[model samples]
Target chain A: METNDKINQMNDDELNKIHSDSLGLNVPENYFFESKNRILNKVVTKEEPKTIPFYRKKTIWFAAATLTLFLGLTVCNKYAALDEQKIADQLTDSIAQIDNENGATAVSKNNFNNQIPNISLTAENDILVSSLFVEEKEVDQYITNCILEDM
Target chain B: MANESDFIDQLISETHRDNAFKKLLDLYQVRLYWHIRKLVITHENADDVLQNTFIRVYKSLANFSQQSSLYTWMYKIAYNESIRFLEQNKNKHSISIEDVNTKYLNCLLEDTFFEGDAMQLKLQTAVSELNYKQRQIFNMKYYDDLKFREIATILEMKEGTIKTLYYNAVKFIENNIEILPVKKGESVQNTENI
Candidate 1:
């Protein structure tokens, strides 16, 4: 009962019986044949080059569309931000120019009052106010002439 | 050897590969099926693993370095595929491999294809009782008659280790199983040593 004496001394004949008997493991009739065919069918199918039509690939189309939309939105957003910044900078320059013109008019009136203390003050003030409507080219020339005279 | 080399070349060649693969399936499918069947313990699982083994062999034919015999290479693939199938089932059921084997043993008891007698069933139970590696070595040695060196090569274990594990497994089965004498008139239908 300690050890199976048969296995210890089992001869080749007994071993062959084990090999030939298939260990009571049976398959359905013609199972191997059918299984071979099935395996072959699968292998052949796999071996054949798989060719999917480009038009039939929906995921690729979807990915491409998504990328295009993302890029389009990003480009539009960048340009929109740039345009807004440009308009703000233009408005800032315009306000700076208007301030400079007002400053020049005040400075010119002060200088004229100091130089012509005895002249009629009402008429001179009217002329100085009228000069405020001068074109930008004429004002630039006047500012340059004032700077040169001061130098 | 020359013939096998030629065959291997054909298996890797595009024009002749399909035909050569068909020949390979004819030669190895039954043997591989039985090997897988013993591991999985059910015809359906064996069938699935066998098909997968052949498919793997087909796909990997080009990488065959001819370092080992074609039989050995294919046997290795079949062995790995059976293990993979078992692992997948183990994971799917959220159970250990031992639990999966027990579940399969229960299935085998109810399987129509399993016609083992009481002695055969006892031997199977004893074999199942061994650890997984020991079980594999025992089956491949006892049932398939694979040499220790070949088993070592397939399992990537040292030959001495394979021998030790195999003898230990044999001892375990021998100690567990009871040997009944054959009746004078009855034929020896059960496996030897059972």
Candidate 2:
């Protein structure tokens, strides 16, 4: 081992003079320039933003259209409900006008009575009842005539 | 042009990355080409390995941990790529690694780009005789002129180990430097055994 070390040390001294600066390896002219250009081309290809064609954006457009359609349907349903409400309000107003002009029929009077609970009439409630145009005796005679006709 | 840290920042940043990488290629391409040439021993192979090395460097810049210098890191990648190329060629030809080296070396004289004389050929043969690690350590030290510390970092070996391997490789070359009058053809096996 000592002899080997001595030989190695000697070789080191000798080899120090003999540099490996050139091993007679030569490249083709412009090899580095060509290689760098090739590598840069590859890198540039990778770095460029990938563009999706308009046809390929189908899912995004599809989702947007569906959402718009859903919103439109929801708004239409809401307005339709409001129109129904407005028609109801108009019908109620018309009925109130008719009652104001022609007074209460027996059916409407009975419906109003059915809606109210039985209670001792206060003086104010008696006045409200007396203000109605319908007479109770006439309503009873009309009812008696309808029963006779049916018989 | 900036300090290495600033340069690394530019390399990892999106806006400045492409220009920084081009600068990197300009700075290291020739140096790396020669380094790889000494190992794989052909202009074509060196060109391939160098390009691959730079491409890897660009892709892996974001992951560059600053523990080692960028120079050391790039050398490590080039070394690995060269080894990988040699291994792939060996597998493709169904030959041993030594045979692969021999195959390339035999073709050296015929290669249009190889201008090596008999002495250089002798030296290359002596180098090829060294084991894989010793050959790598010796080449980096002798040709690339990297310090023992730098070689240790590149090869991930202890400095003392690299020194020892380099010395041994040199000794082997010195002992084996019988001047080859001509390139060995079929007799390469006999000469290597000697």
Candidate 3:
């Protein structure tokens, strides 16, 4: 074991000597320039514009077009709904005006009738009795017609 | 309010500046490259890892809190890059380290790179004999002259463990050196076996 240790030490010394001796093996003068050129070539190759895969480009275009179509449809629908609401509002306003005019005419006619109380009550009673008679007669006629039709 | 501390703080804050990056590269490139080279065992692999290490340092400079020494952080990056490179290349080679050594030996014998350099040949043999971790520890400690503390930080290991690995590696190299033939016409020295 001791001998082995000594031999190992000797080997280390010898290796160290070789290492020192081999130091500064003169690199050829153009070595660095050549290496630089090689590196530059590699860099250029890496930086060159790469053609995108067809599927990837197609997917990007498809996504963009789909997005634009969706946004356009959403905006168009929103405007269409707004226009529909405007037309509905105009119709509702016309109906409300008609109802107001009818209510006013009915109140005015009631006020005019109040100015002629005597005739108003008699006329109203006559109208009521006539409407009741007409209704009853119509019912009797309907029943007679029904009986005749059956016969 | 020491001047030196202020200067170091200013320097760290300016690490994003081109001059500061150049300074850092000059200071650390060789050391980091050698550290990486030892693990990957190829110059090209080391260069790639070294470049990646610097690029990472550049990208992460803004996040560098001077909590640890710059050397420690840089080494950690280099070490990780080296390991990653090794793992990436391991599958491509389709050979284990033992097989790699045999191939390397065959290449060395035929190649002119180490012609007439018996010491270099012997050194290669000795290094090849080490296991992966031992080679890493040995190279970092001996070749890079890194302290056990620095190695521990880089490797994310305890200093005591690094020390043990270094000792074990040295022992392995020493025992294996004798088995290797010295040079042409040299008799083998009979050394006491471990």
A1-151 in candidate 3: lDDT tens per residue?
Answer: 3464455446544543444354212233454446544444443223348787867787888999888966775575567656665765565566556658776444343344344333224445445545544777787898999999999
Q: Rank the candidates by DockQ, best first.
A: 1, 2, 3
Off by over 4 Å in 1: A1-22, A45-151, B179-194
Of 1 and 2, the candidate ahead on lDDT is: 1
**Candidate 1: docking tier:** incorrect
Off by over 4 Å in 3: A1-151, B1-16, B93-116, B178-194
Docking class of 2: incorrect
Residue range B17-104, candidate 1, lDDT tens digits: 8887877775566667777888888888889999999989988988999888898889999999988988898788788878876675
Question: What tens-digit string does per-residue lDDT give for candidate 3 at B1-194?
Answer: 12423434544564335545554554455556567655655455566877777777766766777666877887888888877766566567886655654464554454322342555566677776677677777778666667788888777889888888777776676676654333223333322111
| Candidate number that wins on TM-score, 2 or 3 | 2
After superposition, the stretches of candidate 2 with alpha carbons farther than 4 Å from their true spots are A1-21, A45-151, B178-194
lDDT of 2 by residue, A51-151 (tens): 99887898989998888966775575567656665765565566666777788653454455455443332444445544444698977898999999999
Q: What lDDT would candidate 1 get against the real structure?
A: 0.74
Candidate 3, clashing residue pairs?
Answer: none
